[model samples]
Target: MITTVRDYLAAHRRAKDAFPGALLLVVSVFASMAGPSGWHGPRAAPVLWTAAACAPLVWRSRAPVLVTVAVASVEVVHLASAPGQPLVPGASLIALYTLASRLPRRRAWVIGLVVTVALTVALAASRSDEVFAAGTLASFDLLVLSVALGDLTRSRRAHLAALSKRAEQAERTRDDEAARRVTAERVRIARDLHDVVAHHITLVNAQAGVAQHLVRTDAEAAYQALGQLKDNSRAALDELRATVGLLRQDDDVSEPRTPAPTLADLDDLAASFVHTGLPVQVTITGALRPAYPSIELAAYRITQEALTNTAKHAGPGATARVHLDYGDTALRVEITDTGNGVRAADMAATDGHGLIGMRERAAAFGGTLTAGPGRGGGFRVVAELPLPQDPGDAR
Candidate 1:
């Protein structure tokens, strides 16, 4: 409750503006009684000086320089009128401190020094006997203490402002990073969808056309083509489900039922290609160790994209080979086709999004991918992905 009240008053502009004036008024009342003649006595000159000194304090915080001048002029007049007597200290102290806090450091320091020196000279000229007295020393001490206090307040406010600025900058950086990641993830999902749909749908279209043509003349062949069509459709649906699973929120309980494709699914992948009239030979070298989920998925997608490219460009009577070699430090994948259909010109002219997506996927796992015409005749794709040293790091 107390903290709430303090915060409310701190934000209230009128309350803040009134505080300095009220404090100065109270101080002036006290200083008036300290004169040679008490407040109860008829001392019109001291009362007048006190009023003049404190009156300018109403604008002290708002116009510190103007207030300082007004107060200092009144103090000098009081000193000149009543020699060897000090005017009220509250008005000069308030004005000097307020000026120091509001102004720049260099200017504040200069102002504080000038004010202190001017007051000391005026007081000293009034009484040579009491120039070096304890009262004079106390007066100087008060002026120094006020400037120091104001400088301290200024430093603290500047530090807080700096901290607030850094915090805001950090927040903006975090927001930008999050937006970039979201954009990258959206692009990844679109690529995955394209790979899955393009491969299966192409096979489906071809098989559907074959079944339609052979249904009247060759029933058995048409039935076989129809079976392949159904298989291709199922595969497309399964892949779509798997890829779509990635889009679910973390709290989503109902994710896609189908599991993500991995190296283990390579045989199924090869079988699908065989049914599509392309003979694919998959060779695995070295002991297959458990790999990171992302690496395994990347390897699967790279192979799928390579085979899709082969199906699209390798032409008839072409044979394709997929080699997976697990080295001590990395996993190497190479896919080659022995079809002259994919000419050097075709590979050179290729600037398709599929190749770009494949390269991005490989690069995500600290891997590298190279694709071009094979040494003898067809197309080739080679990818190498670095492996974690510890088996436990596979996740």
Candidate 2:
């Protein structure tokens, strides 16, 4: 019961129009009872007029202009009946304030001036005394004060609403940015896993085939092939573990054991392809220089993916070449294979995510990548990545 009463009181506080009306009613009753000695009117006359004036205030917020006019009209009648009474009552002030708060400044002020003038004239005509008495001036001042206070309240509410809208927009923008970053990170992780698994598994599959073929005729050759297969499997597992480690939560204390691959690891990569019976020749044109870790990683992954494709599609006697050109402004990586293995039409029809991943990686650094048939009847992929102006700025 107490909680119910508290809730009721809270709701009543939020709706304050009734409270003011009740207070004005009580004050008007008391004022009527305490009228001056010269007052010979009926005891109920002033009370009825005051009650009519204050009752309209209940709907002030819903129809502020109508309520203000009704209350002002009633007060004017009451003043005419009893000139010695107050010129403007609390109900009139409340109605005027509601009008000013609800309507625009020009309309509210114009209506307020008209009502003030009408009430002043009524009070002046009823009083055979001074035209502009102190009570009339005070009433005018109170009316102006009510309009000013109401306008201030309206301005303050508008400002707070604008601030709330801006805060909401900023929150939405932040959420969108965070979602974009999360999506980009997921794509990067998936691409890395694909590259690692595809490169190592391709070599392991080839070596397993070789080992199986040599098991009966050449035991020594079979043993070496099996060893290479084991090494390839182990390397694939290591890389898979490293790539998957990126998904760990911030609280995880363990770190990836092996670092990311770079251009320096190209020789080992070429050797692995050679082990699978695909000859890979690596050529560097420009002077070697340090590059950002991200650029190096992208370059290495592109080269690895290109060679993997070459091994899988390039038939017997097909050789691959990796050319790295380090220019002053950009680093270019090109991978080409002899089309004598897979026909140009078959290679063009090949659909896979490797090329897509490479393009994404290059574009991430504001670079460009192109893959098509080379002029020498071979498949070629060229990627050019811009370098920072200062070598020291590379990260």
Predicted model with the maximum TM-score: 2
Clashes of 2: 0
Over the full model, what C-alpha lDDT does candidate 1 score relative to the true structure? 0.82
* Candidate 2 local lDDT, 73-137, one digit each (tens): 88887877776765446787888788888888889989988887777677666665454788667
- Tens digit per residue, CA lDDT, model 1, 1-395: 97986787589755664566566666655665664554554345666677778777767778888888888878877787788775546678878888888888888888888888777667766655455777777787888788888888889999999999999999999999999999999998998997898789868876787798899999999999999999899989988987888888889888547777889999998888887778999999987788898899899988998888888788778889999999998999999999874753464466266687788999988889998888888899999998878888997
Model 1 misplaced regions, further than 4 Å: 1-18, 30-44, 58-63, 84-86, 126-129, 250-253, 341-351
Candidate 2 global lDDT: 0.84
lDDT of each: 0.82, 0.84
What TM-score, to 2 decimals, does candidate 1 have? 0.87
> What does each candidate score in C-alpha RMSD?
3.2, 3.5
Which candidate ranks first by lDDT, i.e. highest?
2
The residue pairs in collision within model 1 are: none
